[model samples]
Target: MIVVQNLIDAISLGSVYALAALGIGLIFSIMRLINFAHGELIMVGGFVIYALAGNPMLVMALSAIIVVTILALGMERLAFRPLRKASPPTLLIASFAVSYFVQHVILMIFGSRPMGVDFLSVLGESFEFAGLRVPRLQCIAIVVTLALMVGLVVFFRASRIGVQMRAAAEDFTMARLLGVKADRVIAVAFALSGILASFVSLYLVAQTGTVSYKMGVNMVLIAFVASVIGGMGSLTGAALGGFIVGIVSVSLQAYLPEELRPYRDAFVFLLFIAFLLWRPQGLLVRRASERV
Candidate 1:
C-alpha cells in the first residue's frame, strides 16, 4: 500500500513536470530557444489567482490564462523577435536576462513572502478506498495530464495550424519558404505554452498550498533538464524523461536512509550525469533529417 501510494505521488509529480516540459519543447522545436522565462508564466498565473482572492473558479482560470498568454506573446515580440537571427548563445543569454528581470519584478512588487493559495482547497483532500490511501490531487492531476496530452496529440495531428507548427518544428526556414506562416505558428506555440503554465500554476498551488515567485523556478529547472534528457526537440521524449525524473526523485525521498535524505538531489544529478555520458542524444529523438 505504501509503495502504491508512492507510485501515485510520483506519477502525479511527473505529470506536472511533463506538462511543463511540453511547453518548453514546443517553443524550442520551432524557435530553438529555451525560454527560461517560461517559469514566469507559471508565476504570473499563480499570482493572478492570488490577486483575485475568491473569484469564480472558471473565470479566474480563463483570466489568468489570457494574462499569461499575452505576456508570453509580448516576450516573444519585445525580447526575442529582434534577436531572431542571433546565435543560440545570445538567445540563451537574453532568456537569462528575461528570467532575472521578471523574477526581480515580482519580488519587488510582491516582496519575498509566499502568498497563500487557499483556493481549490478540495483538491488538498486525501481519501482511502480498498485500504489504499491516495490524494485527490494526485488522481486529478493524472487524469488532467492524460486528457491534455491526448488533446494536444489530436490538435497537432488534425488542425491546420498544428500541421504548420509541426512543419516549422522540422525546419523553420523551409517551412516558411513553403508558405507556412512563421509568426502565426510561433505565436500559437507561445500561447499553448502559457496555457500549460497556467495549468502548472493550478496544480502547483494545489500541491503546495502557497505561491511564491520562486515556485516556478525550480519546477521549470526540472522541466528544462527533462527536455534535454528526453531529446531537446522531442515532445514524447520530454514527457517520458519527466516521468523518470519524478519517479527517481520520489523514490529517493521515500527509500533513502533518513540521514542521506538531504542529499537526494545529489543522487538525482548523479543519474543525470550517467544519462549524459551514456545517451546524450536522449531517450528518444527525431531522425536527423526530421529534427530542427
Candidate 2:
C-alpha cells in the first residue's frame, strides 16, 4: 500500500514536471533556444498568487495566469524578439541574463523569505478513496493537469492556429513561405508556454505548501533534464520523461539504501547520460518526414 501510494504521488508530481517541460519544449521547438527565464516566469506566477492571497481562490488563480502571460509577452518583445537574428549562443546568454534579472527583481520586491497561500488548507480538507487518504488539492491537480494536456493536444491537432504553430516548429522557413505568420506563431507558443508554467506553479504551491523566490530555479533544471531525456522538441517525449524521472526519484528516495539516497541525482544523471550516448535522438524521435 505504501508502494502504491508512492506511485500515485509520483504520478501527480510527474504531471507537474511534464507540464513544465512541455512549456520549455514547445518554445524550443519553435525558437530553437532554451529560455532560461522560463522558470522565473513560473516563480513570478507563484509570487502573484502569494501576493493575491487575500482574494478569492478563483480570482487568485486567474490573476496568476494573467501575470504570467503578460510577463512572457514582455520577455518575448524586449529580450527574445530583438535577438531573433542573433547567434544561438547570444540568445542563450541573454536568456540567462534575463533570468537572473527577474530573480533579483523578485528578491527586491518580495524579499528572500518563502511565501505561501492558504488555499491548500481550504481545499485539502478531508478526502478519502478506497482506503487511501488523498488531499483534495492533489485530486484537483491531477484533473486540471490532465485537462490542460488534453486541451493542448486538441489545440495542436484541430485548431488552425495550432496547425500553424506546429508548422512553424517543424520548419519555420517553410511556414513563413506558406504565409503562416511565423512571428505570430512564435508569440503564441511563448504565451501557451507561460500558461503551462502557471499551471505548474499552482500545482507546486499546493503540493509544497510554500513558495520561495528560488523555487523555480531547481525546477527549471529538472524540467530541462526531462525535456532532453524525452526528446527536445517532442511534447509526448517530455511528458514521458517527466513520469520516468518522477518515479525514479521517488523510488530512490523511498527504497534506496540510506548511504545511497544522496547519490540518487547522480544515478539519474548517469541514466540520462547513457540514454544520450545510446539514443541521442531520444526515445521518441520524430521521423524527418513526420510532423511532431
Please write out the lDDT profile of model 2 over residues 1-292, one tens digit for every residue: 7878788778877778888888888888878778879999889989988888878888988999999988998899899998887777888899999999999999999899997676556666647777777677767777887898899999999999999987777777787889888668878988998999998888777667787889888778888989888888788888888877888788877888999999988888888888889988876775221121
RMSD of each: 1.6, 2.4
Model 1: lDDT equals 0.86
Error of 1 at 123 (Å): 0.9
**Cα deviation in Å at residue 234, candidate 2?**
0.9
The per-model lDDT (C-alpha) reads 0.86, 0.83
